[model samples]
Target: MLRIPTLCALLTLTPLASALELKPLALYQSGYPEGTEIVSVQVSSMRVIVSNSAQGQVDILQLDPAKGLNRIARHSLVAEGMGEITSAIFHPSDDLFAVCIRNSDGLKNGRVEFRAAADGKLLNTVEIGIWPDSLAFSPKGDFVVVANEGEGYVRDGEGFRSDEGSISLIDLRAGVAAAKHSLITLPDLAGVEGATQAEHKRLVERMIDGEELKIPFGTSPEHIEPEYVTFSPDGTRAYVSLQENNAIAVVDVLQGKLDKVFGLGTVRHAADILDDGQYAPTAELFALREPDALAVSADGRYLISADEGDTDPKIAKTKAGLPSGGGRTVSVFDAVSGQLLGDTGSQLDDMAAQAGVYPDARSPNKGSEPEGVVSFDAFGKRLAVATLERADALALIDLDQPAQLKVVQVVGAGEGAGSGKLAPEGLAHVEHNGRHFLVTGLEKSGNVALFELLK
Candidate 1:
């Protein structure tokens, strides 16, 4: 028989400690369109804002967390227009946000639209280069940088034809479109070798429409290759993920030049070597290998990168690409110094492999990729990741122990145990009216899931 006093103390401690553990309070189905791919989430005083790109429209949904997942407002874009909305972000202070809309029709150039956060009213539109995939604001919030996917086309009877890719810099303060930077052009072996009258006509048309342009950096820039971009907390440094090149380029924003280029998989530099070895010890340059998304912690202590693994078939593929493997993980880094801080989410792949589970081979689950990472409550103690594939689960990471960041909770779409479909794409935490919320976008389902974080 246990003593009453001892048992009471144990009960009190157990319940109190359990209550302190971080967990999802509720999960609501967004009821968005089937093809709707939810891209990003931002929380504000008036509403819980979500961005979705599907059916050739950018749909914004406002939520009442207290009332549950009901849409307070909605916005749509026409199919024939610049309909593919790839990324959206809110301004730090104002109720204004920007969306990068990709031109899927191929007739017009890509566009960046600034809208009022309250009702989704379009305020201004800026025409960017082809297939703009991602956008990021400088630390000072004075300018917007875009990663234009650059020319989308296919083969013709004579030979292969593609559009020119480029990046655009838009000055918000100037209230005008800035200069456009063209992607470096590479010598086309097939086009040059198989030159024909039709091929020449296609090239001339491309030249007329700003195709086959030079990047000024290098040759043969792949289509829409610059997939994602992120800025340091101070906005002094900018990092762009060159997906096709398997590299991340560090750019000096003030100088407007590439400072260093580091490969994702190889060790390129000595850790302690620098201009002055006595001070400013240089970090060892290590490769990230298939980096997809970038996130900086709220405190600006760490930089987090999501590695989606590799997809190229001709290259050396890991077991992750195999039918029995799910292959997804997140890499952490020291934000100030750019030092690799190890990786997390290996358990997902290990569990899948051990269970003989594999993602659909043909679909090549882009949704399965770990697309975004965010710190919970802005304390940098807890981290959340959206696993687009593996059934769209949100992983809660414990960052207290810097050496061993572990997943504490895995939240799915429905109330019941793993009852709903979640293809979470992007994540954002916002505070309004003194309350905080966690928001995520689903790519495959085109819905955004909002949850009230338990303190």
Candidate 2:
């Protein structure tokens, strides 16, 4: 049963304008044990798919805002030595959904498992590249594209061994079971025509404590790892977020190869970089916009990213010697030219502080890490919703004026008992019965929260 927490508090950042309003509906707990990470939540016309990656299980729920939410079915794949379940997405126009699983060894090839949305029956398993981090369907639903992260791993006495990251194009024209994939490998940054390394040096070297420190922009082709993938409105091209490399890869879908790769550069802002049980933007730092998620506007004019910061060991080590790290902002870019248009700066962190949910423990690291992001149309406005992993809140941003971005509202996880909406990971918005609903999978709390958008 869906239950609303009496202790939850709704913090409205901007005045209730003629914009979208988020009302807390209910929290549906999975009843899983502690550490059961609900990393992904997606809503379809039929049901809601909640991925508990920690336990290798997926829970299917029925979210009827007019009534209540209920779990209809559950699927588990918790055997030893198998790939870890990363994410799941429903087919655009079919009764099917696919789940990405990273190989347990992390260096071997990962696989994607497609299942029927009706009864959660196995459809087919397709092998892809190493560490399939995220996947998406084309605009026409004719193909399923997977971002093969291929992250580097350090073995005992062997030092670091890196894998070449690539994109896997899964053709679904024949059918789901007959689907086959082809790999699209990335080219050297210097080899891509019209691409230059100078643009990526926005924060290549910074002065700290009277010494200049150099940061890695992932200039090498092997250092590239695709974190998230998004398609254009026309499906002619796909935009991928290279988080640790602080870059983006443009893939030509028709040609089945990488078109171009460009860096996201860096951002300068004042942030709270200490875990002293206090929250204040007292330190100024220059950090990379190592975006973790990518979202394109409906019109295909803009590309949005949640600058979650770098996770690469080299980048993290360099940042450790500095003042701060992490993007802590949502950046907007030109979809066609890959140009940085605008960003939210520190507004996301400010909103969390204002709501009294700022995670001081993460201040010394990536403050309120902005991870998952999704864009959609509602209330006669173009908007983007971002998940603040550490803050346990959602940042609702207005993209109407992309350059002058605004945090219209901050839907925070209420405080006190029975409000375990922590570390929101996956997000999906849908309109049902003429009402708009936003669903989020709470990673740490093992719960799913549903919010209704009111006019």
Candidate 3:
């Protein structure tokens, strides 16, 4: 279930906002198993929780600068029967938090976990859809939405196909009751542009593995992977990112159904800037707008996305030219209509190169690879932060304007000034005590980098 649209959009630039500086606070090492990386970070009024996949648990830490970072609680996800923890979210207005764990059964099952934010006491556990990759809580703490990324490795007749992606809406009003919610699978995306059987067939027909991995036509929805989710301001609706499908799904929570699927068009790289994957200021690669993470705008009218296009190396190597997939832009879209509201263009890539932290080796495929995004307001400025995994950096963007986004800061992931550790994956904007913090979980170095956003 996929659709292909013929019309492509060309974007224009807008004025940028006044740039601000990001001050480095400190890098706290996650003292888990060796190579046990920190994948997600969530901050609350009192605690900073991180999901460590290697250790298969969530580590709670104290973020008081006077005493430095200290491990306060470590909850075992597996011990709690929740398998490996992929992500966690703190309740918007309460002293509680939720965790999304992948069930040991892999593509077959998953779970949602709840605990006290202050003490890390296990309060409840509920089963959700398969391969729950991310979690989000409504503003009033009435529900928890889980992104079940049922990956594409399941059985398809005699061969294998993708697991149909679904979203689990667990009701929090009846606290600790596992049966109070609903699970909604997305409607087949076969009608959305580029998701049709004919288009999918044309893609696989190219001999990468010696032959086209053929399947029945008109079955594109199975290729989708629900990667991330963000709720509408009132919590009545949800905007979910379908990373592999290059689309976003809208769901009406109370109605509990997959409402609409919006196709995110591809990005045309400037004259050879990214074609060869070398570090240059020319557009060489045309990437698919496969958003991995999303943040709802302050007004709830737009959906801010980090298009960290994930292209397989084996697939790219098979082509002589840059693949016709992936996009290296930070974009915004109308939430309801799914209209293109403009994007950051190549500003992020250009700035990263100027900061001397650009991953030249990774430029060809996904220049910066923005994996995580979170939005927060300070004073009057509407701001969002994205974790650039390959570049090992954090990029902040001002999102108050309608057609433009200003690059606020480029926090490096190195030993230089204003830097964090390497391979920053998950990001969160939080207030601890009275200070505003932009926290990141480093995937490669196994550390947590904290930045104080200077107003």
Candidate 4:
């Protein structure tokens, strides 16, 4: 069973003449057992769906921005030979959602399941290979594209290695996985020079586990390494973030081929730069780091990529790498032109250093690392972002005036007040009747916080 909490205080939000009025809708926490982690959230007109990776279940909660929060329904999925739920999203116009679950034992085989949004009823399931990270639906809602994280373990001459990663194209209309593409191939690394044979071998070995793992023929020249996938408003173009390669790959949707790759900047060794210059090297890591969470504006004019700092031991083992610094930061880009549009929110180091919470430069919780960005308002004026490491806060970015962005108004999840103590993970705008509200999933506390957006 799921639990819903009542809001003790409801503040009437006044709208700014140009901005929309925002208010606190009800907030509800998931009913999973203690220690269960809520990984992501998706909101539909009638319900808000929360998924727990640790519990291996997806809970459906009734949302009433005007009345308060309520858990109308809940359901647990059969393990389906996968480990946990990594990502999920509701179908644009239906009560169905798609989720990607990776294998628990760290094998390459994963699964994608389609379920009824209202009751959490299992509708269909498909087995996939490797760790699938993100899922995006095609414009017509006919296809779903998955970004596989690939294999994690490698054999150093003793045991069986795990190298599984690739992207699978599932035909929703046909209810089957139509095509699978390996992202570790060289073509995926086009325009990337200095990629050595050892790196290629490492990438290949990291994608599939055994000697039987061979590159597929007729695979498009596009390199894999895809982390998060998003589509344009009209679904005409698909933008994929290639975290390992430090670039975003734009794909020609209809043709299903890589059109271009946008690199963030130069990479360098960590020890060479001074403290003042340390941020430069760190900033390079942001550009080159794995882009984890991705969002497209409602109008499809902009694409935002949230880079989760270096978590890989292998990458961190490099002398140039510093312990993943400051919380995370976001990069906004022109979806069409592929141009960079500055960053949103503060970096982990800046947040930690500013808060005086951690005196050491190598402190772990590195204050305020921003993680995910979901969507902009219907007018394309405001953006809602999630800060995973930075307590509970949703960053609102003003698009009409780019210079005015990053001026955030922290709401709900009272980090200072002590009412709530969870980091915000996923965010989305939910509309009831004609009013707009912001919904955020608190990963640490296993709950969802609702806030009204003021104009």
Candidate 5:
């Protein structure tokens, strides 16, 4: 078990409404550099795989009921020129796992490597689109989808340039050896079946407005970066987060095409738009729900998003001289229609403040930056676990009543870095041997903290 000197910070917080509690079990140190980030994590049976992005490697660990988590193997560079590991996910039924790796030069396309979960041995290597940032497997374990972000960069002289942001659909029906990779390029907004002309116009007006883009990049089809991906229950559809554009792309996995692109419009709510020491909801601003992580309900009826806010700072200066088009809450939307259902208005930020874990420094920006989210069934209740990157805490929201959503618990991870920031990036929920666990990767602290769900 790891020492939690900071857990007492939440003792004075309000009581949780539900019986669910995250009991801290132990912390597994990555044994890497001090600033090395443990961003992505996934568990299968007794095995766990974590991504060490700064070091460009994936560390495999084994969970023992008698002991704790122990490092089993470390793997890196399935092929030369591969960059940092972006994300990793284990197969539902097989002893296999997939990882998204970007190009070292950041100019070429990336690849997804399938490896064995037992020993982290490379099984298959399939090249995908540029900058594959996130990965997801179909429910039935027949297919794996990669969200190729295709991030843009600026040179010394030339302006910003980017690769076409696309999605990669890998067919693993025959197995990883026979994987068939296909890239689904995002069509223009006008060509998308589910995209509305009015939504497109509003987005352009908010970001461009027929003038030179105040931001660094344009919100064109090629520049629409895919951040995270979640699949439908039946494995027929996939939802991809278009973070910078403040939209979501629905991909038809079977047909292997970009079906639709619908924008997640702005959310006007009470928030703290200043970095002052006072934590007050003094401003009512219209924030663009630039969702970073997404999760679809098991019934495929509701799509939930953790809006971390990726709006450009330059654009915020133009918007009433305040940080308006930013994300700081989780939102719920109708899965099929892409209609807004309900969102936690200022609840997340408020809860963090009350719990004494809110990052007051981030108030002027996206406070509490809820970056990673995962929905799972545990303790006879449907719950969504959202990681607050800036606050170094986890918000557990009850999803049984989607419309009447309640934040049941807000638990702090542990002691943060020397700068008082843990920066929890990726989250994974696993049920093994009759017990459920929430494994979180703390990026700045270089540790994977395990929490056992208990009544």
Candidate 6:
């Protein structure tokens, strides 16, 4: 049995509407089209990059946290009909940036384009795989990772989907001026020691659509989709979130080998999820945690994941908009040991519910839907900020005690109704003018909301 250690800080469940406050200081609006959305937001020294999916452009906005946004520049990653931008990130030094653009040629090809951070001029482009959802920079500024989520195609007759997800490592030992690009596919990561290959095969060992297969869901080791990647503090290793596969891949960057892939087994004891399709006020809990966005601790000791679950395109949507398999939780892991140290189970969902920011309509499968995550050291605490998409809220977690994680605060409607964000996605922590703050990208509303982290 997986023992869930109690949160020593949360000796008693504090009623939600009361906790640390997350005052929304500002919201910057961009006139991108309705279909086009701000899916990802990455911050630099004094600028912000927002990836416009439908518009195929990456906008570099001059950011003044106290003020709003100034559109300093923008660049279209693809031709009018060529492709679209998936995600973007700036180099550690803030001199250059990169964007992963997926070609429109049947989701067949993708590329990582390097550009000048200030002028947004194209420097170079390197070929990668299909459907790159997210990317990241190494802390040492020597490499970048592109998570190519190869979402398969389907025909009317074909019963299952393709599993061609992968990750591309762009080595900049010689700098972006001259770089080497390499791929680390799901198949490559499968056999590593810490990986869950054997157990995953056993659990998924069944037939699908009358066809006898190694795994039932067309999701085997090779199909393990790479959704997001975060680097360790020292830049010697990285962790990739396989959202659908329910696994995390640890790569040794310096050695360029698979260090290990920690299999995050299903959440079996979650006690706060909404467990019915009625979208009722009543609530219960179940298990099944599939994480999306992930981050590493400053000391490189742990990894934090936002367990926002997902399903296939072939799967029908419910009235509540949830996947059949999902655990409304936040999980923490021992990076090197690949041991699941602890998780914030349905506590996040319970927090959202009490805050009244919980999206009842998105119950059962995705209660809070913690998506974007970022970590930093704040006031002597190893802290993390999680963006709850369905709940339209931001949560601050006290990670000082990794084994006994606590919900230090919840920012949502209960505290300040209209001040809350809607469908928040990406999260970034920043320090400027000797003050701490958080910046997030709001997808549904196309707004960038900023909050001052009051100590």
Most accurate candidate by TM-score: 5
Error of 3 at 267 (Å): 1.5
What candidate 3 gets wrong by more than 4 Å, as runs, is 1-19, 33-44, 65-68, 79-82, 152-158, 194-219, 271-278, 313-323, 414-421, 431-435
Off by over 4 Å in 5: 1-16, 34-44, 78-82, 154-158, 190-215, 314-316, 321-323, 417-420
Clashes of 4: 32
Reference-based lDDT, each prediction:
0.51, 0.73, 0.68, 0.54, 0.75, 0.67
Our model 6 lands, by Cα RMSD against the true structure, at: 6.6
Candidate 6: tens digits of C-alpha lDDT, residues 52-92: 77677777776686575666777766777787777887777
lDDT score at residue 365, model 5, on the 0-100 scale: 75
lDDT of the structure predicted as candidate 3: 0.68
Error of 6 at 106 (Å): 4.2
Model 6 worst lDDT window (10 residues): 312-321
- Candidate 3 lDDT, tens digit per residue, 1-455? 11111223111222244645567787777764233333333443446777777776677777775665567877765664547777887676677678887876656778777888676787887888888888787777787788888753544467665567788988777666443668887777766773322353323221222453533323355556788988988898888888767788888877777888888876664522333433455445555677888998767887889988643432245255434445677888888888887777776766665565666555555667788888777657787888888778888788877486776666685464213237777777766565667777777777778787776
* C-alpha lDDT of residue 56 in model 1: 48
Give one digit per residue, the lDDT tens place, for model 2 in 1-455.
Answer: 11111222223334245457677787878897433333333434547777877788788788887665688878785555676887777777677778889888767899999988777788899999988888888877788888898774533353344577888898888998789799998876654332324333323343333554544444465566788988998998988887766778898988888888877766777777766766667676567677888889888999999988754232235434342246789999989998889898777877677666777777766788888888887878888988888888888888888778988777774342113347777777777767777787777777887778777
RMSD of every candidate to native, in Å, equals 12.4, 6.7, 6.9, 8.7, 5.5, 6.6
Residues 301-397, candidate 1: write the lDDT tens digits. 7766666643333112213322211125566667655666656534333222222221323122221356666654434344545443443556555
Tell me the TM-score of model 1.
0.69
Which is superior by lDDT, 3 or 6? 3
Candidate 3, position 298, lDDT = 65
Model 2: ten consecutive residues of lowest lDDT = 1-10
Off by over 4 Å in 4: 1-24, 33-44, 80-82, 158-164, 174-225, 266-289, 311-327, 345-367, 378-380, 415-421
